[model samples]
Target: MKEAGATRTMKRAVNIRIESKQAEQTQTQQAKGELYEKNGAYYLRYAEPDGEMGQTTATVKWDETHIKVIRHGDVQSDLTFRSGVRTTGGFTLPQGRLEMEMYTHGIDRKLNEGLGSLAWSYDMYTGGAHVGRIRLRLMIEEDRSE
Candidate 1:
């Protein structure tokens, strides 16, 4: 992936796994993508598998204190997580609309130029009712096979 005016953009292999346990089922979404760095932050981009309309593009931007994820396609969403704080983001998706408040309680990350990893967890609520606990993990490695 390449971005205009970016300090650096490197081809990378990204493994992203998102797990959410609501009720009794644990749903997981995994994908491979690209990674790059700009200024002092890192941005990872990936394409969701082609659906009936085509593929959805998603980008994850993170730094030392916060993580923001944006997805665009048939549906659009922007979610944010701040270190050890409560952050709220809501958007409509193909599954439905999810507009809730989430409290992040866990955050662990190690990022650099060549490789990086981030793990975070939070509990979501809707109308004061416990929604579910969600965890997201990312593993990034620079692609040097070229």
Candidate 2:
């Protein structure tokens, strides 16, 4: 099988569902979030339940087989991930929940060759505090020449 090539950019939107465990959190905390991509860098805005907000930026790199996410922040919890077209090392955040559903093309051949679509859930904790959790589902499809 032939490996796929990376596109210049990827665009996706996720619908967030508030779990029972997270319903009691502050609405300002949820509303104070932003996602932006510019010049190959990604930016994320996070708000804490206590009404504190912070921002993090990362450089996104991708190939046919994997993705590399490097973050710039004072804390290591700055790096995070979502499912791409192929298998990837996902991410964890400092607070709240992030869920992603990914769709790809021409991955069945890779599965037959012992490389399978990647799926995972990550929960990041600091001390006894439930920092955050992320869930991702990846889907693969075939590319169309037409």
Ten-residue region with minimum lDDT total, candidate 1: 1-10
lDDT of 2 by residue, 95-138 (tens): 64343322222211232111223334444444344545444322
Model 1, CA-based lDDT = 0.71
Give the C-alpha miss distance for residue 63 in model 1, angstroms. 0.5
Winning model by TM-score: 1
* Clashes per candidate, residues 3 or more apart or on different chains: 0, 4
Candidate 1, residues 1-146, lDDT tens digits: the string is 22233466655675655554556776666667777777767788888643642457888887667788888887577888886788877767677887878888777776556256777888887777887887766766655555
Candidate maximizing lDDT: 1
